[model samples]
Target: MSSFRRHTCVAFTAAVLVIAHSAAPAMADDIPGKIAEASGILNDALDFSQPPVLPTIEAPRKTDIRASIDRGVAFLLADQNANGSWGSATRTKGLNIFAPVPGAHHAFRTATTSLCISALIELESGGLCQDVAAVAESIDKSEAWLTEHLPNLRRATSDAIYNVWGHGYSIQALVRMHGRHQADAAKQEQIVTLIKSQFDMLTRFESVDGGWGYYDFRYGGNQPTSSSISFVNGALLVAMAEARDIGVEPPKRVVDRAIAALRRQQKPDFSYLYGEYLQYQPMRGINRPGGSLGRTQCCNTALRYWGDLSITDNVAKNWLYRLYVRNGWLDIGRKRPIPHESWMQVAGYFYYFGHYYAALSMDQLPAADRAPYQSMLAKLMLDRQEADGSWWDYPLYDYHQPYGTGFALMTLKRCLPD
Candidate 1:
């Protein structure tokens, strides 16, 4: 084993020992059966007997990718709150423990900061960002804040509709942190402990149907029904798969059951359901308008990251790319403003998030298939970057810009050649 891997194992063990008492284990006795069933169904979903061969084409990088990444990092550093998180107190005010709202700035800080950290880590990992020392400092402060605030942020509110996004992103960032610190055994171990503890926390909160829900399903009367969101499940699965790849093994049953939940909800056309019953309905047609398009980008990207090459290949050729081709991703409402399809009003809500995930999907594709999408995404993103090295989809009282910048930087990192 690599020295870092060994350190990570130790860190996980140490973290489990330290935090085991505080965490409550999930009701997982029956999960194994669910896993078995889901596995059987997923096996039938694909003809894995002949997996497609991914060609080894070299990824072509846009000349400005590195500069764009650095500017994004600078934007994040400039906007970071004194508390080390990236949120505004005014927007986060009016917090009632039970009645949390998605627009609340506090509601997004941990996740946003986590995303920034993940982006910075990716730049550092790929050696794409020029300011190495500055990047390290930015990551340290943001990571410290996240680690400290995670417990409080994990608390449930009455309107916890978008909590899963935070949890999913949090794990993704933590896993990246663990992987990037491999050269420093001590730092890697410290991050591994955080990763393990958070994974355990996440496992305890897995929805009743073997997936995660937008709400904290454990309490708040939020029970996972047939109407769960595929985006949440996909995000959790990608996080779990990445964690496992980095040698921090979550409970096998938890990972298996989550994968099973995804298989059960996946549509034959490669488009995932917005909800359990609302399969293909696009985010179950949640509050945001034109959300189906946004959800498609995130869910498919997550699926692609977890080894669904078919989704990536098809998306580049005949799927969502077609939508982007005809109707620019800039604003869907400009072309068609159906009641729920008001892209202008709501596309801003998930604009950066969607593009970030979509870029991730392209990053995993074989070079030949990845080039065109990479070029397209790079141009679209570069065109939208603000003069201050920041990006924002919706200016919702001071929270969206930094978070959006975080998402954009992460996406741009993928555009750079490894």
Candidate 2:
């Protein structure tokens, strides 16, 4: 094992971090899926969550699926630039912030970190990435930084608003590391301590009914909306997944309460109904509009139990047909008070939730129905990549694009290998 991959089984959730030169685990057989050949599969199609690319390819033959995925891998390798990013090396686009401790004004910005990480996890699972070096380097540095700094989380951020995104980044990095056998026992315990602190901090900041606002608990100022709720939900799910991975799961009641709270907040359309006086449905990127930007992930994660697949599936199906698909592909509403591009940030829920569960629901769908999703997903990655190797940051909610960029990168890395 590489030095970074040195943690043993006792280290608890240790993920291997094979530096570029280290020997790789035997590459798994090629993943079965559609290659990057098609582009217009869903550009004009309607009434579906994604373009029917991979699933359609899956029905005819498993061999074809494997081949398509291999071709896609080649495309990814071909796309990489020397600077490590798949595209340009420009400073990521971001909001400018004046930090108290900096010689330079901290540029407030991030691309879609969440999507990026999501995608990378898939590649790690598939073992097909061609240009893994650049990302591997980023992960190594980030992991070292995370391990050294996880225990210091409370110092960097205190509330959900300030630290929620940061916390999400920390969670994804840990999740990746633990899988590689890097997060040893001490690291796991430190994470546990940080989580306890974060949960308490959230509860303290939340309102009476258990919702949140811009800075902390919701009040007369700005109130909790679906988009913000989704970000928080992502953080909690990360917590739950990590806790379970480390053998220190949160109380069943705590998770249950959070879900129940989410269910109570849902409207007839399945979108979240939030705000103090005004209420509206969550849209693609609408931040604090009359309605909020609630998506399927909230419903999906909120409904999961230790072994309750039925409940989660039911929730996902209901929301997919009603709230999500019914809304046609527009941003679905006007811009709000926050400073954001609206749809760009929030619409990402479609790729992550749509694919994550779609994969789960794969065994159930007809071949034709699923292909478009795969095609659409691949197209989305190509369309969204900034020349600088990151995604555009979510406008209002995500001031720091790197975290969101991380999420986006993760997501793309999962769904599309090349």
Q: What are the RMSD figures for all models against the true structure?
A: 15.7, 15.3
Report the lDDT tens digits of candidate 2 across residue range 1-418: 0000121243322222122111212112222353322321233222234432222222223333344434434433344333322322234335322222211111111112322333455565666454567546544443454445444333122222434444444454455555654447776566566555545544543434444333333333333332235435534554555556666555565455555555555544344433322235334223221123234444444345233344333344433332222222212211222232223233323333333333333223344443434443344434444554444332333332343334344433333322
TM-score of 2: 0.55
lDDT of 2: 0.38
* Candidate 1 residue pairs that clash: 98-158, 273-280, 274-283, 274-284
**Per-residue lDDT over 308-416 for candidate 1, one digit per residue giving the tens place of the 0 to 100 score:** 6656464533333422332233343221212223322233455666677777667666776655566556665786788999887654446667878888887776666
| TM-score, every prediction | 0.72, 0.55
Off by over 4 Å in 2: 1-122, 132-134, 154-160, 182-207, 216-231, 274-294, 305-372, 393-401, 413-418
lDDT of 2 at 162: 39
Best by TM-score: 1
- For model 1, the superposed segments whose C-alpha errors exceed 4 Å read 1-61, 89-107, 158-162, 216-219, 222-226, 277-291, 304-312, 326-330, 333-347
